[model samples]
Target: MPAIAYYPPLPLNAGISAILCAGFLFLAFRKLLRDKKRGKATLSITLAAVFAVATAGLVVGSYQQYVVMNTWSYDFRLEVQPNETVRESLIVPIPGESSLLAALHLIAGTANWSFIETIHGRGLYFQFNGSAGLDALFSEFAPGGAYHNTTLTMMNSTAQPGPLTVWIFYSGGGGVTVHFASGGMVMPQSESIAPGWRLHQLLFPPVA
Candidate 1:
């Protein structure tokens, strides 16, 4: 039901685009049939075909994006490596874990986040789609230690990008969540999430 309420519904948007495409095609057909003027008929036909193809392409593109990031969330991972030093400080533009989360965030609309912070230094766990991807993302500590591997997840439900864009600060520790939801399970504004979530949050935290 929640997912259903989400804007830019696949079927509806695609249907509308398809109709426009078909309308252009029909108009072109009528012109072609009414007066067999090569120049005019050719123009109409070309336009109609372009509109139809474009609309259909939109449907296909939207569907593909939906399928890939339907119920998705962005994630970042910071490895609290040995010596309390954060690794991967210098993130390149290459396709790393962050890249995946960045892409997912843009596709899901920029804002509408539910921040869940866990003060516990417990090992990080995650789930991608249905399978457990990042089981635990914590390095061994010499016993008592602070939260070296912390996750800052910015989750949102109303992320609808105009054409799928780029936002790096999205939520997820388990990877991009692409599963549909039946409501409930979202974190409150003031609460913290724990245990296992197939989401990841990664970015160089401000070092002291």
Candidate 2:
């Protein structure tokens, strides 16, 4: 099984990793001391090595979470009718300890969007945190460019990728228009969005 990731980095993940590392190391050390007292050098060394690896894993995991929380930036292309434009790179100051999901919520605020799954758009977008049951419809794909607007197709099908569209009508109070990527055809759909960027069900369901 793959190593579990800590979502909502910082205190949650950091704390968990810390505890795991601490508790495991403590056990490993006790075993080593006891074995050493008995002149069991081989077993003691093995336990020590395992303990080292565990500590390293925790350190790496904590760093990954930190990168996502603070440095991650999500660039969403808003698609609106007609020829009007709105700010694209959404960078709202949220807590560094917040998860990517929380960051997305902050940027989107209370704006509601609609998503339509196309006939061939039956794939799923695998997420970094790896929550099996999470819907790809609302999950982000990849980044496109510097603004990093690519999409990673995470479909659970063996068939070739199809098309998808999202019609986002921002209605928090006034009107918010976006650069729509019709059919959910985000650039580099085979790639992944940079850390920090989030993808929800920004697509309006296709109507018959």
Candidate 3:
């Protein structure tokens, strides 16, 4: 429904856009020359336009991938205290769904790391880790700022235990704390102590 964005502010994105645009224009001119030189059927300008748009898409996608690789890191864990079982999922969001979700959650120049969905249901607990690195830059949302920190669909989700506590730790050294908007819950944050930041010990009840 909305238009696709080619982020031209970031050097990485801008460079790709410039190159793709140049290539597309070059192709158009070349096609024009061929049409004149051969004196054959008129060249299809429509096809040339489509090819240019496709090239732009490819360039944008590739640049997105490069951004994700150097930006975010995630560590997800599910611990069952009663059963003494723990499951871990560590993911580095590439330029795909995960990274896209992270991009959606980005708070511009403010927060770096953010959690998408942390819910307890069907006797299982789920949590996800998403973050923007210091080097990560933010472009204005395609539509407007109305969607800032606001999401239409959940980014990432996982499940483990119902009566579980979700702990999210963010990188970047400082006296950081997890500030909850739904409720005024604050968890002391840290960069790295000998033990690292202890997120919180939340207790959840099993779903009926």
Candidate 4:
């Protein structure tokens, strides 16, 4: 699948602009109160109002960006081979923002697996080894779709011998759930997901 560029959070300059506007607003208000001339007082009041509005707008935008950066959630289930048993289930607490690379790194770290990045054509994948070797491909959220998804396939090896299937489901509250299972297992329905919840994907070297 083609990787789509993810939207970035509001820049730090936005927050800085908010702080500066707030300072200007305070100064304008002080000037308005201290000035004795009616004309100068009117000008100071106008400047204060403009600065107040600008500060409010920037502060709101910055708060929204902060929320988006910290609130994304992820869930992963690793099904053991031989009988498709769910051996390990983990709810990854993504500290700040949601990045496929970060999530994969957390998973690998928790499982004590070697996380290797493999570049295939124009795409990137994760090849990790635990009890068995596996290749994981995380897909960008579908256009106009509510959820992001990933697929993990077992690599052919002496222990596993063949590829296994993995399925993903997204919950309404902006959480991603990944289920690893055999090909014959039935896929589960997606949970409710919030509309327009943007999840960021970390693509190396960037993608257009």
Best by TM-score: 1
Query: Could you tell me which 10 consecutive residues in candidate 2 have the lowest summed lDDT?
Result: 127-136
Task: Please state the error at residue 133 of candidate 2 in Å.
Answer: 30
Candidate 3 lDDT, 101-127, residue by residue in tens = 333343322222343333321111122
Using lDDT as the measure, name the better of candidate 2 and candidate 4: 4
Q: For model 1, how does the per-residue alpha-carbon lDDT over 1-208 read when each residue is reduced to its tens digit?
A: 4565656666576777677667766776777788766776677677767767777877888777655554443333221111211211111011222223332221222122221223221122221222211211222322233323222223322445432111122133322222211111212121222223323222233458
What is the per-residue lDDT of model 4 for residues 144-172, given as tens digits with 9 covering 90 to 100?
Answer: 44343343322212334332322221112
lDDT of 2 by residue, 1-208 (tens): 9999846644464456556556655665676677544345455455656655765776677677655545534333332221223322222111122222232321222233222233323221221111111111123322332333244333323433444322111212222223323233343322222223333233344558
Error of 1 at 200 (Å): 19
- How many residue pairs clash (N, CA or C atoms closer than 3 angstroms) in each of the candidate models, in the order given? 19, 35, 2, 2
Q: Relative to the unseen true structure, what is the C-alpha lDDT of residue 105 in candidate 2, on a scale of 0 to 100?
A: 24
What's the CA error at residue 45 for candidate 3, in Å? 2.2
> Candidate 2: deviation at residue 193, Å?
29
lDDT against the true structure, per candidate, is 0.35, 0.35, 0.34, 0.36
- Model 3 spans > 4 angstroms off: 1-44, 76-78, 81-208
- Ranked by lDDT from best down, the candidates are 4, 2, 1, 3
Backbone clash total for model 1 is 19
